[model samples]
Target: MQQLESLIRAAENEVSRQMQVCNACRYCETFCAVFPAMTRRLEFGAADAHYLANLCHNCGACLHACQYAPPHEFAVNVPQAMARVRRETYEAFAWPQPLGALYRRNGVTLALATAGGLALFLLLAIAMKGSLFHEPLAGNFYAIFPHSMLVWMFGAAFGWAVLALAIGAVRFWRGQSPGAVGSAAAVEATKNALALTYLDGGHGDGCNEEDDRFTLARRRFHHLTFYGFMLCFASTCVATLYHYALGLQAPYALTSLPVILGTVGGIGLLIGPAGLLWLNLRRDPMHGDAAQRPMDRAFIVLLFATSLTGLALLAWRDTGAMAALLAVHLGTVMALFLTLPYGKFAHAVYRSAALLKWSIERRQPNRLRIGGD
Candidate 1:
């Protein structure tokens, strides 16, 4: 904890130092929320650094546009600096503190969680059904494991994830109160977040992405990934409604609402994560902290795997392979739910919290005035 504290403070200080330089020039105010938010305060403490870091989309436009960037003494790399602190912010506010360290070794954590999930379900299948392989159950998922049992397992994991994320976001919000949130501010923040307003380089010309080259490739992939996840969630919600409200059971038709939603969402997840992984691999080393790549890619891979297994389960549901496929699908989902709180998934919550702060703060007047020192 002490070492992590030191690292966090160091990252905060670097952001503060860079903001001091940026405060004078204001060259990139049009780049993103970070610079404009920076002008509202002369100094960035832990709270300020964290808020701005999450606000940064790491679009790399500001870094590429900065005259004082690397190769000069200033060495001002806002994207990289902010990236480091944003990662630390995840750790700093993580619930169960010790579990927060999982963020550092996210790839390994993800792999272990995935393996454990697969093993659990596979073993459970054998214990309950007396065999891993079985005849087609007619797409009856409840045959191997009862719905109630699955509910208890997934509900516990999902509930814990939600609780942890809520706690962490509250911790972050408490560290820096953004005063009052007006209706307009709330609406603005929602619009920005939903539309991913910052990925456009603070304009509509797209982002400088990995190589400081302007492109909307990242933005499109992000939309696919985020909305894809949302669609999948909606599918689950719809299925729950069917089961409880309508007393309907599983094995919905391919044209059913739940199946349709999941299928479309699964396709988006496939394309989105594949594209994101490609971009992550090709990104410039200086664009962000290389150390956090594991965390980023781990989350992407899990999402992709979840969708892949789900679609496969749907495809093979009527076959003798249905039971095995169902186990694998359930296992992937179990891992995804289990690690939601401690992994890259938390970034969405953090970034949304930060954006809400920015919207409220931006509603107020700027207090700082730039001067040549």
Candidate 2:
């Protein structure tokens, strides 16, 4: 515990130190939200560090632009510093204090979660019907695993993940304690987050990626990934409404709303994760803490798996293989949900919170700019 706390402190301190140099230089002030946000604080406290770190987006523009990065006495690498701090902040703010350490071993956690989920579902499928292979059921998945049972099981996992994320966000919000958000601030923050404004690299173009070059590849992929995930979620919600409200059961038509949403979303997930993984693999090692790459890739791989299994199930929903595919797909979904709170998924949550803070903070008076002593 002491060791973990020390690591967190060191990360925060490094960001604090880097921010001071950055504040003085202000060369990258327009680079992203992080710089302008940094100007709002003459000193980066724990709260300030946490806020700035998450807000950074690890875009790498500042690092590439920094004259002081590496080989310099100050050795300012803002993205890397911010990334180290962001990872620490996620662990620190993670709910279930004991589970916080999972962040350190996220890759292993993901693998275990995946393997465990697959085993559980596969075994459950066999136990349910006494055979891995089932008679043709025509895509009615409820035949394999009862709807109520899945609801209860997945609901618990999803609920826990949501609760953990909510708690963690609350803790982070309290840490920064950014004053009450006005309607304008909230709207602005939402817009920024939805559009990923910071990834713009201060120009309208895009942030730096593999080398000194700029690319919108990351931003585009991110959009596809999240939007795709949301579409899949929307499909689920619509399907649920159809089930209970409209008396419409599983095996909705190919042209139906639910299937369309899932299919489109699933495609987005496939393209987005594949692109993101490619970018991650090719990204400059110095762009962020290279150590966190495994965790990032793990999350990406999980997203890809989730989409792949889902699409496969959708494609073969009418065959005897539907049961088997459904089990694997559910297993993948379970893994994704189980790891949501403790893995790279937390990045989106924390970063959103930080963006909201920025939106609110930007509206308030800036003492540094006001006095100018």
The 0-to-1 C-alpha lDDT of every candidate, in the order given, reads 0.86, 0.87
User: For residues 213-299, what per-residue lDDT tens digits would candidate 1 score against the true structure?
Assistant: 788888899899999999999999999999999999998999999999999998999899988888888888888998998888888
Which predicted model would earn the best TM-score? 2
Lowest lDDT 10-residue stretch of candidate 1: 364-373
lDDT of 1: 0.86
Instruction: List TM-scores for all candidates, in order.
Output: 0.96, 0.96
CA error at residue 301 for candidate 1, angstroms: 0.4
User: For residues 214-259, what per-residue lDDT tens digits would candidate 2 score against the true structure?
Assistant: 9999999999999999999999999999999999998899999999
lDDT of 2 at 175: 77
Worst ten in a row by lDDT for model 2: 364-373
- Candidate 2 wrongly placed segments (more than 4 Å): 116-124, 370-373
